[model samples]
Target: MANPWHALEGVQVSDLGEKYFLFKFFKEVDIHRVIIGSPWTFKNHLLILHRIHENEDPLSIPLVLADWWVQIHYLPPGFIKESMALLFGNFIGKFLDYAMKNLSNGYKNFMHIQVQIDVRKPLKKKKKIMLSESNLRKI
Candidate 1:
């Protein structure tokens, strides 16, 4: 039988420590498909995909301001920042691994990784009015 993980053979993996690994691909990969297909394989990893810039330090890779970004929620009382960082690192690693293996055909449109946070404000409460009174006035 062929190895199921064979596709990922070319991906470069780095240990970021704290259970975080960095997976880097040599070519651009479709982030949308990666995200859509991630849950099946990366159930335990938080997968974050970002474009790798040439000559730029990975630590300073500016966040892409696009529609696809990770949302950070208030952690339950005991969750620490270190834990969150590890989770994010794991995601980045897994995403790179998946992209390298699955997106090898060619680069697709909108292939860059973009990040944006969606903020939804609660709707204001509306005051109740008497419909009958309004109807009577109209009559």
Candidate 2:
């Protein structure tokens, strides 16, 4: 685990008993890096990480959220901006980051953004967005 994380100051991983473990990082940047680079797997099983907050129950806190990069395809020409991608991402889940470099790919067919989502929840395959009552686009 520490090998893949590549923490600058190294990390201390402790077994918190049964399915749970604690990760101690020397820098906040390391923690941020790990959290952003989510949906990790070891031998095909998902590894969930949650930052233990002050006064929070380690065992009781739910660990269902994971950061995912979603590619929005077939977007209309007018909806390719960062703001629009953010709106669509927020509609799907909590928006994290947008692929700024991919803002205008060949033909402007897709937009990619990272969002934090609950793995336990079923994701929507398609959604209809109404910019106004007169304009509706299915994404």
Candidate 3:
């Protein structure tokens, strides 16, 4: 049977040499149907077969389970900077949550902790630093 999804332009799908797949798209497109439908069908088939062989050795059960994950990368015309900032904020939040849980004792007496983030535009020209005579001699 011919796969209809093969006709999609700017879309590339490749196996990751494991139980994972990498789907890349060059432009914005709706891929919700493919993502939601394919994994369920494959996993459901595994589940059905597992049930049929209920008497199989328990140690071999994990080998028959089907697991899949999808990671989407979408870069629009002007949203790259905004998306990167959002991702950075998410990472910081997760890191703080983990640190607070593990190092709770260090912050127990503090009323509040303030975090300041400075974001500035990069300079077009690089500035050279002048070295003192003594510093040059040490080098």
RMSD of each: 17.1, 3.8, 20.9
Q: Residue by residue across 15-105, what tens digits does model 3's lDDT show?
A: 5444444455443342544433333344334221122134654334333322222121332223223333344333322111111111255
- Extract clashing residue pairs from model 1: 46-91, 47-91, 48-91
Quote the lDDT for 76 in model 1: 31
What C-alpha lDDT, on a 0 to 100 scale, does residue 70 get in candidate 1? 36
**lDDT tens readout by residue for model 2, 1-139:** 8899899999998887878888899999999999878878877988888889999878887788888888888776677788887888888888988884353445666778898888898896687754753454432
| lDDT tens digits, residue span 1-139, model 1 | 0122233334567876554445554434433344344422255543444545567555554332223323333333232234433444344332221111113565321122222322232222232324465554553
Query: For each candidate, what is the lDDT?
Result: 0.36, 0.81, 0.32
Q: Which should have the higher TM-score, number 1 or number 3?
A: 1
Candidate maximizing lDDT: 2
TM-score, candidate number 2: 0.76
For model 2, state the Cα shift of residue 73 in Å. 0.8
* TM per candidate: 0.30, 0.76, 0.22
RMSD of 2: 3.8
Q: Pairing residues by index, what is the TM-score of model 3?
A: 0.22
What's the lDDT for candidate 3? 0.32
